[model samples]
Target: MSSVPIADHALLSDCRTAALVTLDGSVDWLCLPRFDAPSQFARLLDDEAGHWSIRPVERARASRRYLDDTMVLETSFRLSGAVVTLTDALATGGEDLGHGIGANSPHLLVRRLECSGGEAEVEIVFEPRPEYGLVRPVLSAVDGGIEVLGGADRMVLTSPVPMRVEEGTASVRLRLVPGRVLLFALHHSAAGRPPARVWPQGELAHRLERTAAAWRSWSELHQAYEGPWQDAVRQSGRVLQALTFQPSGAIVAAPTTSLPEGVGGERNWDYRFTWVRDASLTMDALWIAACPDEAAEFFSFLATAAGPPGEDLRLQIMFGVDGERDLTERVLPHLSGWRASSPVRVGNGAWDQHQIDVYGELLTAAHRLADYLTEIDEGTRGFLVACADAAAFHWREPDQGIWEVRGEPRHFLHSKVMCWAALDRAIDLADLLRARGRVPEWTRERDEIHREVLERGWNPEVGAFTQHYGSADLDAAALTMPITGFLPADDPRMLSTIDAVERRLTDGHGLVYRYLAPDGLPGREGAFLTCTFWLAHALALAGRTGRARAVFERALAQLNDVGLLAEEIIPSTGEHLGNFPQAFSHIGLVNAAWAISQAELPAGG
Candidate 1:
């Protein structure tokens, strides 16, 4: 396990929830019911804690990929004379498979094992550690298989193979013949609750087929988009959907926990929660694919999450899937961090920081989905109006900036532009609403914000935009100028800014730094994946399609074998850093691919 890179992991989800599965047949990270919910199995952050793993007993070669369009993952292990495959997914609700669970339902992990050739020995290990390695859960026999418990938290494991229940864990050794199969189901909940009814093997099989069909059915709706990087674009769309929490349509930042930013440094922060920034971008990604249902749901989540008008909106950079706001940061002192990066943090402390750009991001998303916002409840509208009003007044304040830097707030150039964008979008919304008799004051504030940004944010001497008011540092964030329609991609300033970024921010291989200056904390960081994607989009928009495609291909080369990407990539070695499967990176990939597919590529093999 230590030999495998973190990028080897793939993701599986039930739309309402998700988990991280490694290539070697281990579910290293999972939080039971919701993305922000505490983990029942957190071996990714601490190996000795509880995790459910099944792999061939003998040394073998293993490979994996998603099953068609669905979130279902297939990992095959080949021994010298035998082959075995394992399929994993969370039981989803509704449709044919009946694998879906409600928003408030307890968490579950369903894994199926099949022997494809000859007979091979397989091992099943269930080590349940509680409280992030603080408690050693006791494994006891249960009706179907076994149960591991610590205080109120309960982990139930069900398997067809004979098992050993020992100190704090369960194990099984089985000879998997060609016709033999095993089903392992893990249930997490309070101790006194009735054990969840295990899905019969036949029903589980039916659900798996139905789930695949459902994903394909949903994917068929994307035929409207015929851009150049069609396959990659569509894959990005599918990934966004897979990462989304379907009940509310809110997209999480990433599906994994403690996949360190600095590789065991204190930079590790929980990314399972929904970010206002991420969910907003998700709306744009879904909209580009013509998926209105998802767009509408995310818009609604924003409205409810932003709260009523006039009161300070709890504009967390991130939130729980159910919209819970308090994500208290804590460290697991017992477990060695990923690659020995100490202080594995579970919750995000940035939740309480004031990120002024959130309102702008929220408004931009809502405005993009304005055509669908009308279909949402009236409260969402009120929240939108109220949020607009708050942003109108607060747009001038300094914030933590888009990077969510832990350092003191400065007037980050991007954050300020987004503040203006928030107002601009709100004004656009106001006009759209006014034709039908809605809020008119929003239009006035939007105009005022636009004027203020042009005057205060631009730097004349640099021939390019700077990182903040009066700061000379260049930022890759300047790339958003054209993408947001704030300026034409070919506009003098925009072109000069792109050139400036190319000169200062872009390293030789086309990887982009978030900014040239240090971001308040110690140590260096990887080039941001989203920035490179933005560069692709900007180049495409500026009629540099060939350059755009070249850049796009270079960026796509960074994707892991499973086509998953992290928040940042180490420029030299390409080791993934920051959050794994970052939503912004995926969103950027989708948008850039859409742009690049329209650009012609050079003659290829």
Candidate 2:
């Protein structure tokens, strides 16, 4: 099993794909061409899976940071009497493009090493494993670097220094003096396609400069948040943008997959796909922290991906980056899971689950972006209306909740509330567009659903809203009630529910469990980072500013050194246990930080 802590890795992206570089200078996890593509380096999952590393020959201390408001990562390593800095990024459109990085731009991974002080000896290892380590490619020396040939894929690596290929791996050792720099570029393409041209050492400097500038330019336009927790908020926004598939404007849930939620357990899952709920929340977070253009593009992608509304009105829960619907889950038994968390999964099985709450999320996103939208084509508007109608029809149905529990479907209170929100936002949108006549039925259904939730979803005996209708289980997801505007934050019922959640769901360290109920999964997972952020947001909305700030800070404390968060955190040990750099968790941070900042602002100031 791979022993590298998830937090030790930093992310690099060109807005189309992502690569995770560890502090020790190893590219352990990367999917080429697209976020969900088969990885070339799977060392994060197993030691022998595959990896490419450029690290000092001797033990060295290292520290890393992003290059000022960008996804470009800089890691500085210091040896006994030497120091070097490694800059890593996936290449993007340069200054001459007259714009920021485009998703369809070339696929190139660039690494530049510069000796900042004294001199150091570094070793470079390049091992390419295609199709998740099942295919060992053939390596050959060509021109300035090496060419990797494997099933249906070709990767060419160009290096500034000489390298030797041995047993399908490339190895090199180089001495770097002060002010000296070495450049390496890897270009990927399909086997039958023309080989990608390798970048020369002279042109690499310009490419690196352009990539950094492109990221900075994009950050300048998208990041508008100037509130408290400014640094964390902005970093989270950048991480979200990095995870976005620029071509489709679809943001994935997370880049890595099958990172266990619980060590040595079976709860591991693949999170690289774009879930409707997650993508919708991403839109909401982007609107607040970044801009509305991303939200609009994502909605358009969803409309095209979801196709025309069917009679049933149910949408697929998630889709591939290219909008393909066949996300059938499968296991790779050859690879031992992370920390022995077995049965490493690839595709997600949740695609077919009937998640009724997605309607609410999609409609709410549409409503939020309505004002900023350039033009809502009649077809898209009609599609949004149908989604609201579907929620009205399905509110009475039992279905899988947001957690996507593998257990039997139940009438989860959160799902019911979101169903109500669907109608609410749909009604609001109709009025905004002066199409109120089209959604009169939505208004009536919205009221009825709201009343039904109050009557059946709340458990007065427990002094809190139950996890499901007629059950007394407390759920962190219920904390979204106020955040979604389904109820006033300070309402007596809402307040009681908050208190009950703190009393029951919290791990006593400000971390929150999704719920304690049996989830049909074999192992217990950690506290969900996003849910913890929700608790903070809910508190701020309730006017408990002091307590809200405390909870918010506690949640912020869980972020890794580089200000990135995973899907879950071990409350006792603070170990990041799920997919790293989770979009949902970061969205939670941005939204929660926004709420806290707004609440702290002097009234009308």
Candidate 3:
């Protein structure tokens, strides 16, 4: 944690991979070839890991923003009398590639420098430490540029200003006037792949332009949300798109791994894979922010990726972008985590945990995209039908809850409610999925869950529906009871749950915590940002739009300068914590905004 606040970084993507750039123009976190691949730069986790940075020789006031609707980042650094702008993008194949916009990306990162004010001086630092800072590449000057050789990746750094590099480190300084412009394009090639030709300076600039254009075009055609928090909703839509793996239609929870939930504690976990639960919610959020095409495609990807829905009705809680199973969690004790949060993890052990809530989420996403999925094949149809069956069978059994607690599994009310949601949606989609015969079975189980939740899941002692059956502790997830329509928003029980959560689970601020219960992890964690949005959404649905607006505005204040949010917020400091650019946080933002907008609509307007 270069002590760099997680919120201070901006995201750049070609929809294939992502890079996190700090305010001062440093690519602190980036994974090439693919989002979950070995990092080419891991400075976000440790100081000695590889990083490429360019900044003014003197201190400068920095301001950054995405280029309008696109994911391309533009940062301006102002000093004394000079101002220099840095434009960065991961190049994509331009024009109408539909969902395949980045299918033909050249795996090139383009950073363009331009001077628009008085003369300025800047320095460029090139360091390539591949395989998670384990192998330091030998830098050699080539005809086109510098060739980095070592590890599993060969990187070519092309620049107009020449610099002699002996080891893995290289530095060059350049002076720029009002009319001056410099370009650096770093291209990557892994073993067993034919390496593309080194891009010339002129072509590198051209590809950068095309990448921006492609992103803008993608936004224009897809992002049609014209409601409250329009700017944030649109920006989040781009961020979610940026996190998606183009070829697989899988949405990663975040790009970086091992950013701590509790700084200087052992609470860090990797979030670079496609979580079935998260991806399902992401589909619903994206449906509102963008368009239905992605939602449809994601369902298709899910159907194909999770295997033939298994005779045992089992599916992974999460899967690799390419649908690979067996995600074994391991740690790299070498890299001292951000802020000394040691034991940087690579893979997630939660992937193997029995997260039974996924069935409900998956079927819920399918229900939302039912119209777009009219042409789903029989295999896909059968898979979804099997998912509903799984929910009916597993709703009674308990595994890890939605928070993926490492402790013993209990009867999580949220899991049971989501199971009810699955069966309800399955009944509604019976005709479409050709499973009308199973509706009776699904209905019986659905009603049983509803009855049991109202009886056992609720706590009259606590005046709320507790975290799990018969528990006195409250959970912010209880706020979802109304949002999921399991109970009407204004129902007495749902309102009491909301009031109890606000009264107990908040950080004395508007921000909400997942819970205060021990998660079988050492040390305490920060307030989850997503839970705050859930509070806001619940308030809006419960006819308290005024207070809902206030909560929404308060949560919006936690967004970074560039409108990106992290996974959690430190209650005391109001500082961002956990993984940066978390998809769940943004998804909550988009959905809460939508809920407010809908609630605000005039009666019969």
Candidate whose TM-score is highest: 3
Model 3, residue 361: C-alpha shift (Å) = 1.0
**In candidate 2, residue 540 scores what lDDT?**
95
Candidate 1, overall lDDT?
0.75
lDDT per residue, candidate 2, 1-605, as tens digits? 89899999999988888999998999999888788999999999988788999999989999999999788889999899888899998888665222246544567889999886588899999998988889889998888889889876778998877799898799999998998888898899875656776678878777788888888888787788898999999899888888888888788999999999999998888999999999899888887777756656677788788889753688888998878899999999988978888889999998899989999888888878887654766666667777887898899999999999887899999998999999899877886545688577888889898999999989989999989998988999999999999999999999999988888888688898889988888889999989889988999999998998888898899888788999988988889989988999999999999998888888896
Query: Could you give candidate 1's per-residue lDDT for residues 28-129 as a string of tens digits?
Result: 777766666666667777667667789999998999887776667899999998989999877664462221223333456778898876999989888766
- What lDDT tens digits, residue by residue, belong to model 3 across residues 1-605? 46788888999888888999999999988898999999989999988888999999989999998887788899999999899999999999755344567878888899999887699999999887888899888888877678888877878898787875857898888898998788888899877876844677788888888887788788888889989999999998888888898888888999989899998999899999999998888888888888857766677788888777753586779988888777799998789899999889999988888877888888888998888889888878988998999888888888898999988899999999999999999999999999899989999999999999999998998999999987998899889888888999899998899998998998677789999986678898899889999999999999999999998998999999888999999878989998879999999999999999999999996
State in Å the error of residue 375, model 1.
2.2
Global lDDT scores for all candidate models: 0.75, 0.87, 0.88
TM-score of every model?
A: 0.92, 0.98, 0.98
Clashing pairs in 3: 1-338, 1-339
Clashes of each: 12, 0, 2
Ranking by lDDT: 3, 2, 1
Query: Which residue window of length 10 is worst by lDDT in model 2?
Result: 95-104
